[model samples]
Target: MNVTVFGATGAIGSLTVAELLARGHTVTAYARNPAKVPASWAERVRVVIAEISDVQAIDSAVAGAEVVVSALGPSMDRTATGLPLVDGTRHILAAMATHGVTRYIGHGTPSVLDPEETPTIQTRLIGLMGRTLLPRAYAELLGMTDLVTSSAARWTIVRFTAPKNTPRQRHLRVGFYGTTRIGFAVGRADIAAFTAAQVDDDTYVGRAPAISH
Candidate 1:
């Protein structure tokens, strides 16, 4: 499989690249900062250095991809401005469509609701905090949700909250909010594992499944 990962310099995205390599898949990682990418990976995977807003760079990165995974997300900043992720996502989806790529695995939070989800205390609080505290960033995330779900691709938004730097966890609770009880926190490693696994797994395609330990 030829996998291209956006936001590859991010914590979870880096792990996803490693997991994909471990599972015998070729990887193309798009990194904004060349310094953040490991020198060891230079011989192992293709690295494209470009900002998310670089349209031609993004198009070239996804040109020959079979699966695309995005760990791209807005920082949890209350003062976040200019929906960068939303615009970047729009370009990414357009590139995928032009390149004839179908599978897309992206990241999001529980605040981006699923049709099957029923409001829970945890969910309600998440929504409230997003709107009250991080309004701009929250809106950007929702904008990303709208684009991903509406695109012509087999997409999966791996949703979670409070990711920790803990080791990978097993038996993750993966499902919608109402039916499945999920915790507020999960290991970043676990999230990466699940995100990488999505390249070959269609169980959650066209659905956003919140995963937690």
Candidate 2:
């Protein structure tokens, strides 16, 4: 499979690229600074340097990908206010549509999913904090979700709880918020594994599944 990963320098994005390569899939790591990509991966994957906001650059990068995985998130810089995630996603969808690529797998927080699943007190509190403290980011994430849900391509949004740099358990609790009892945190490697696995999975297409543990 030919995979193009946006925000490839990010924690989870880098892991996803490594996972894809480990599974014998060709990968294109796209980021603003190619230098950020791990030196070890240089020989294994192709590197494309470009900003996600550049639609033409995105279109060219996504041209022949069999699957596109995005690990983009709100900028750590507080002054940044534009909807990069939403805008980047729109470009990705448009490019995919133009290139005939259907599979897309992206990551998000559990706050984006419904809390109707008899969520524990911890889950509710986390969701509340995310909405209250990062309202703008949450709004952008919602906009991104709207764009994805309305797109013509096959998409999967993997919602997760707090991610830590822990070892992969290879075990996950997966389902909608109301149906899946997620843990407080999950390993970044596990999240990458799940994202990579979705490339061949149709069960989660068009749905956002909250995963943890």
Candidate 3:
């Protein structure tokens, strides 16, 4: 499979690129700073430099891609009001549609949904942060979700709790969370593996499943 990964320099994005390559998929690491990608990947994948807002750049980057994976989010330098999630998603969907690319997988936050399991104190605090302290970011993510859900392509938005830097467990609990319970902390490597696995999974297409270890 040919995969184009947006935000490829990000923590989880980097791991996703590695995981895809390990799975023998051709990967294009798309980022604003192509140099940020690890030197080790130079011989393994294609690299494209472009801002997510640049539709033409994105269109060109996604050309010939079989699957598009986005790990885009607000940078710490910017506040929630400046998030590129919504607009970026719109551009990605448009590019995919134009290029006849159908599979779209992206990362999302658990704050977008109501807690179905008994809320841990940590979960409650995170929810409060998203709804109260980071309302703008929350709203932007919701808009991104709506855009993806309405798009013509097959899409899967994997919502996760806090992403940690721990080593990969290779074990994940996947659920809609409306009826099932998952953990609150997941390793970044695991997240990448699960997201990459969706490239060939139709079960989660058109659905957003929250995952945790």
Candidate that would win on lDDT = 1
List where candidate 1 sits over 4 angstroms from the true fold. Answer: none
User: How far is 113's C-alpha from truth in model 2 (Å)?
Assistant: 2.8
Per-residue lDDT tens digits for candidate 2, residues 1-213, read 999999898999999888898888999888998678798986888888888889999998898899999887776455678888888899999999999999888877666654234565665787687778777777777788778867887888888867899999957788765555667788999999999888777888877888888
Q: Rate the local accuracy (lDDT) of all candidates.
A: 0.91, 0.83, 0.83
TM-score between model 2 and native? 0.91
What are the models' TM-scores?
0.96, 0.91, 0.89
Give one digit per residue, the lDDT tens place, for model 3 in 32-96: 98568799986788898888888898988899999999887655433435657689889999999
| Root-mean-square deviation of candidate 2 | 2.2
Question: RMSD per prediction, one decimal?
Answer: 1.2, 2.2, 2.8
Error of 3 at 117 (Å): 11
Error of 2 at 72 (Å): 1.1
Clashing pairs in 2: 117-178
Q: Candidate 1 at residue 69, lDDT?
A: 94
